[model samples]
Target: MTIKQHQSPHTIGRNFRLIAGILALAACAKPANATDVFRFEGFGAISRGMGGVATAYDTGLSGMMTNPATLSLMETGSEIQLGFDFVSTDIEVKNKATGEHVSSDSHGNNRHPYFAPQIAYGRQIGSLTLGAGVFAQGGLGTEYGRDSFLSRASGNLDTELGNSSRLLVLNIPLAASYKVSESLTLGAGVDATWQGLNLDLLLGADQVGSLMGAGRVSGSLVPVLGGLPDLRGAHFSLTRNSPIKSGVSAWGHTARVGMTYAFSEDTRVGVAYTAKSRVADMEGRATLTAIDGVAGQIALPGDITIRDFQMPAVLNLGLSQRVSDKLDVAVDVSRVYWSDVMKDIKVGFVSDSGGDINILLPQDYRDQTVLAVGAAYRASDKWTLRGGFRIAQQALRGSTLFAVVPAVPKKHVSLGAGYAFSERASLDFAWSHAFEEQMDNEGTPNTSAPIRVNHSQDNVTLVYSYRF
Candidate 1:
């Protein structure tokens, strides 16, 4: 899908009851941000092969996050895995600026590399199989350099704004599967997840200079139209120490449970659910400073504590069939309860000079269902191939809260491959590209101006696995 917009991320701070972190992006009744992207989806090859299905029969390492029921699927000997991913994102935005009424087009780059490790061990102790592992799941991130259109607008509006965000989770998982009778296996596990959220917003005269992203930058007269002040002549310090950033630390827990049953030798069914979590210990703080013109700028101190804001609960039910000895297929139906995510947030101002607090919120969304299907084929003792598809529903509730975080059309396709280098070692590679639907962004500071954006995703992953 095409990517666009961050105005939505700011809303999480406006309300506490919606999303978990005032520091993280706000939760919407719809998709949070059309432009927001996740890199964790393809950190490893196995996740790509089965459309991220492993909650029941997971193996290798990263399986820890895909499902807890997979505990019993592990080999008695331990397995360790190493993985890495490279992403190249390109985003185009059409902007309405301060001085010029004419619209301008700007482009940006998303460059980042990620590393992940996964390990799992299982042993038969009488009637039960047990396993444990730690792995990374999906989250959101954005690092936008200040650009010309935004800079000119910031200088004229008397605002300094730059943002950086990161979110990661440490998953402590414990699970077991017990075989009852001859045809049923029941399993469950709790993923005691501790989430870490961080955000940084910077402002100053150089905010424009940074957005333009060139040499030592400078700001001139504040541009104006009808009724407004021209507070100008601010030269910003480009030092890292001058600008300030605000952040939060939050903690919470969620659970997952599942059961797998075989109707025949070639057919099996699986069901699982992940619980929702709330962060009560979320702490926040913002720093204040000036780069060039301190006399005219706003001096501010940030705030932190809020209510039980956080992510939602998710559930999945699946069916897998072995059509032949070398061919296998599976399908999963999943749900996400995004309606529990509505909140209003606030940001404190130094002088209250044209400022009260930054207040905004996400709209009421509904539960959404996804239909995902995948297949795996064994070409030989050393080679395997995989493919999958998923249809994600747009559960947006059209309202004022939906303005900033516009949802996009949902559907995805993936392909992957695996090769055994030895009896204990293998290499895997996978790639997926999502098609985006066209959408319009309306009602900015300017009511008539429109930002048209489309969404698309290109994901590639590589993994190394050694099965002992």
Candidate 2:
């Protein structure tokens, strides 16, 4: 349905005054992960509660990130949203040839569940709406022990089997919106994002065994290894948990633009586009070790630098309609350009004692599209309920899907509710779950052995808002 905002110009001063009171609170909040890889399904509880069908809806401060034009539909005042996301993820890797699996829990102790915070502010001033928000781009990671099946299959020593990787991106968005006519609004925004990444990974036993077995010399050292009897083995091991670690951080920028149009009292449409972000290279210190049988030991100690890492662009279209007085429905379709940015993961290693080595991890990811539908019901003057579902195509499949980054799940279901304590204050809560998904790889450019990955996730969100 079309949610309208008044633009009489008389309330501009009041809106600014109200915004001043909540600016501090809004500045202290941040966003957490949803159900996407390096990307969240939505920006806030209200958006996620409705399965991210928010492009055409007025969802207060949170929705501004999805479509800044939605800001023009806010009540003639100021508001702030503060919330947290509790996320739990399960990741498992299997050796398809041996029929053994290793769970993330088999590694070192981890928090198991983690928390992500969200905050935002919106204020109406004359014919314009102003807003600011903080949230995280989604990411996943897990740690495994050296003694786990992951290590045994690789035939690596106890110290060489451990693995882990974690990525975090904090986005600070500043946006503005203006009403172009009685039924149309346009908006734009800029996001200054800070990204950090910590990765402890390996080539694993399967890939190493395949490469050495081929003896085709993928790199200069591969052919040399074939001549060494000690290096020719059926199994191999590699790890990243040496004295030096592979961790890096950088700053990036992205832009967003959107528009909303009201076709009638009962129908509205919205469209938005986010440009790809430019990110800097990640450099860190780490040791690369490869062991075959008992006498095969290859140690490459160096500073690892991953270059040309970038975030993909996105396009979203949505429609919202009122089916009846108390019920409203919304649908959204979004496309993510993963293939444009993730053709391969290239790492440059400068040896501490000698030369340089370059490793290319081919991803060949495909663009992904997501479809979402949601329904919201105003059950009573004080209560509102929401339910939604979303399904998306996975970015990686076939042999390119690796253990380190398993973006497998494709379906998500969500439920949410809102309770109003007063005309200006309320609480909102949402829960979502992603069904299990798995991928198997027989062999690819990066691996010659059979490997499998499985994944699932759950998220919970709570937000408190006040309007003045």
lDDT of 1 by residue, 190-289 (tens): 7665554444334333333332243222122122110124322222211122111225545666677777777887887777777776555555554433
Clashing residue pairs in all predictions, respectively, total 25, 6
Candidate 2: stretches off by over 4 Å: 1-34, 109-113, 153-160, 204-229, 232-246, 292-301, 444-448
Write down the TM-score for model 1: 0.69
| Per-model root-mean-square deviation over C-alphas | 13.3, 6.3
In model 2, the worst 10-residue window by lDDT is 235-244
> Number of the top candidate by lDDT?
2
Model 1: lowest-lDDT 10 consecutive positions: 26-35
The C-alpha TM-scores of every prediction are 0.69, 0.84
Task: Give per-residue CA lDDT, model 2, range 160-265, as digits (tens).
Answer: 4455555666678899999998789999999997766655555645565554354422444444434555442222122233222226666778889999999998
